[model samples]
Target chain A: MVTYVAIGLLAILASIKAFHYYYQIKRAPSQKQLSKLVLSTLRRGQSDRE
Target chain B: MIKKIAVTLKPYNRVPFVYQKLKICRNCRHFTVLGERDCMSCGKTGGLQPVEKRAAGIVRRDQWLTGLILLLLIVIGLLFSASALQTVLLIAAGAAAAALLWTLSKRFTPALRRIQLQKMFQQYSYELASGLAIDHQAAIRVFQEGDKPRTYEMLREIGSLVHNDQLKLEQIMLLQTFQLRKDMDLMLEPLLMDSFSPDLVAYIGEMAKIRRDLIKENTFRYMLQHEMYILNMPNGETVLAAVAGAAVRKSRYMTMYPYLLIRYARLLPKDRFLRLYKFAKSARSGPLYDEVMRIYEEKFKWDPDFQNA
Candidate 1:
């Protein structure tokens, strides 16, 4: 009974870890916006230089 | 006459994305492209990490926590197991699960890291911009202090991530103050601007004389786009000839700008024309090749350099 309980816990923990990684990867935001965000933010500094 | 200082600026680290050059403070979340070891805002030692590395660190810590939890649970189960067979079975199960978790995490580490990077940028967009702004101000203050080289260096670091015409202009203006030379580490591409500034044309002329290798398509395009304006400036034709001489350094350039060579071929010095002669000697007949031949026949028919070739 103890053996079965430990086995079940291990399987569940592994499944949870796998799911966490998969979900994190699947839900990744589009990287396209990232470049624009950085460039636009930096370009804003033109006001300071002027 | 002012002395020309041999200023050799440092090379920037190559990164896949410009933002990767930015470091965020762990304590203050401030962004900086400067090379200080500590966070400028929080004054905390060892608190700064490149944003990408910081994101990777967060992902790695989470992975470690999961691994620890799995290890702890496995240990607890082993200590409480009643029979040897049960213990053995539990050990095998835990090992299999741990391996599976490890494999999955390892396989998706890069994807996980990208997500973390995006999250950091999204969460702290304002901070990133403000941090770069702070760096710009600091550079300005340095400029106020009359440390032109240091200020240019600082601006260069910031410019890697914060590219704009203003930054390029600042760098160019500072460069104009300095007497440029061949030995100094200079760059051309980063300083090219959309608008025609006489200062930029002057810089291009100097680059042509000392570091002609740096001249490429964009530099050619920029120079040609403002040819009339450039010619309006004194010694503009001389500058164009130097650039043509630079174009002669590469066959690809000759192929791309045969018309340019044709215009400036007569102006190229004997040394440059000789190089053109050697290159044209092997190249299949083309307009540039014909022009080089024409220049040779017109000017160098009796020249010793052509005689040797």
Candidate 2:
């Protein structure tokens, strides 16, 4: 009886974890913006060196 | 004469997209939060521009990567489970749990972004301090892109390390563009001058007017010691009035501004004179106060209520 209860609790926890990732990817801005951010940082670094 | 460097610099080159989502309507001047296509107030679409970032933040990559890896691990764990109805149900539950963890972790995104921006700023500050020259353009870009308080903090950091007058003048020029806080003014107190370039003096004068609370007593003393030549520029009187007002509020030593007050006593505006009058009246009666009072009386005819007392 105890073992069955433990298994049920574990299952519930895993479901919660998977749903969290889905939300993050959904909320994230487009890949293009992310790439732009990276490019700008690189450009700034180069300019600072010069 | 401090000449303006004519560099055709793009103001928004280093600004990120997330920072540009908000705009002010040109037609109505209403602040629009989300819709960029049309002004929510007047429906004028063309005049919208990115004005300011509402929050200090950056995209937190590490947390995102961690959540992804955790989800991937859960998927692999479920794939190895046996093919029974109970096993399938357990796998479904596992997926759900992983999803919750991932999404809940994202709630930390804003907090993480703040921390990351701070860390990045600190690193950059150290770099600027150790370098041979002050990077005015880089500082301007940071001021434009970073959070308001942090930008001032970075300025303070750079300001402390900078010793050259030309660089100091540049820093002051950069500083004037922002709406500065009192604490930032305090940080810039060490840069106060008995004499400076007319342009720099004008800039400092503007700062004194806008952020009066930030000026230290020593700055007032510096002003008192310097000859009146510093105030001969276009906005010199405005600067003097600002300094006098700030000195009245900040100077604890009673004897400090007496000479200045006496010299410029009659020239002071009614409000400023009243402020000085009130401060002098409240202070302990000493020879210095008496002398100051004598000077005030010399400038303006007034009968004191406390003369009989």
Candidate 3:
């Protein structure tokens, strides 16, 4: 009975972790996207300054 | 045009006298001040301009809230480790918390960056307005230096920005630096000399006392300067009470209690001091309050009749 309970808990924890990772991947921009946005913003600001 | 020229020339005639009083950049390593259209030392051709002070980035309310939630989840997870079910629940909570934080950061990073840049510009303007002659480069250098003595120097320059009037931003910056480095002597020196809103002056005095830098006599004198101003205001009294409580808890500046209490006694309602005295008497005696009460008795000599009556 204890072994079955432990397995269930492990499965639940793993599922939760997987779900969270998937959600983050969907919600957050990749590092490349973030860097590109930052660089473009910097260029725009510099042009405006000039 | 003749009147304008005469008016302009008038300043030159007075320049010798004023120049004697003015700080020259030649001796100052941080000096960026120069004549019209050229830096005298560097020969960089531009009008002699004062340096701008920039503000640090502003942390928005949402960012703080998200950060707090993430911290709470992590703490809860650590605390629930004894129970397997609870631990598992907490681990899930932690994963959810991280995901939320990541989402918020991605959405808000640009806005946060803009707020930060604006703050830097504002700080730069404040420094220039204060006569610090700080440019962006100098400001960056000052921030990068980041040693106690260097921080103190930066604070001193910033404090100069607060003269006869209370400049809130300048005062906040100075206080922020002083909070990091408890240099009571440096912090109190300007407060002692300058005229400020009674609440701010009192707040600074309380801080000075917390650091055990204010002797009873000096604290009494400071209180006397704005006694009526402080006594009439509720906010001033509240700030004083908070500082006193904090000092008692910290116990590092125990010697400053007498002066602080004296100021409190004079400004606060009789009932307020009475309650405070009761709290102090019942609370575990520390070096701070012991010295405070000792000084209060020695200086004022209330006798046995006024013992928490």
Best by TM-score: 1
Please write out the lDDT profile of model 3 over residues B1-309, one tens digit for every residue. Answer: 111111111111112111111121222212322222344444444433322111112345545665574565456455645667766665665566566556656665654444443333333332222233343234436556754344334434433332323333344443443432343333443445334365455546456445534333444455546656765776666656544444333333334454565444434434444445555565548643464366447543574534535
User: What are the lDDT figures for the candidates, one per model?
Assistant: 0.83, 0.50, 0.43
Model 2, B1-309: lDDT tens digits are 443332322122222443233344446544332334565456565755433322231244455555565555455555654556545565565566556655666674554444443343234433322221323444556667844444444444434434345446655665555554444333346466545556556665766666766566766666655547666676676676666666666446335666655555555665666666767777757554575577566765554533422
Structural RMSD, model 3? 21.8
Best by lDDT: 1
lDDT score for residue A9 of model 2:
58
- Rank order (by lDDT, best first): 1, 2, 3
Candidate 2, residue B67: Cα displacement in angstroms equals 4.1
lDDT of 1 by residue, B127-223 (tens): 8888888888889999999888889889888877777778889988888888787777788898999999887888888899989989999999998
- Residue pairs in clash, model 1: none
Look at candidate 3 and tell me the lDDT of residue B68.
Answer: 70
- Evaluated at residue B265, the lDDT of candidate 3 is 45
Error of 1 at A1 (Å): 5.9
**Where is model 2 more than 4 Å wrong at Cα?**
A1-50, B1-64, B83-100, B114-164, B170-218, B224-242, B249-271, B302-309
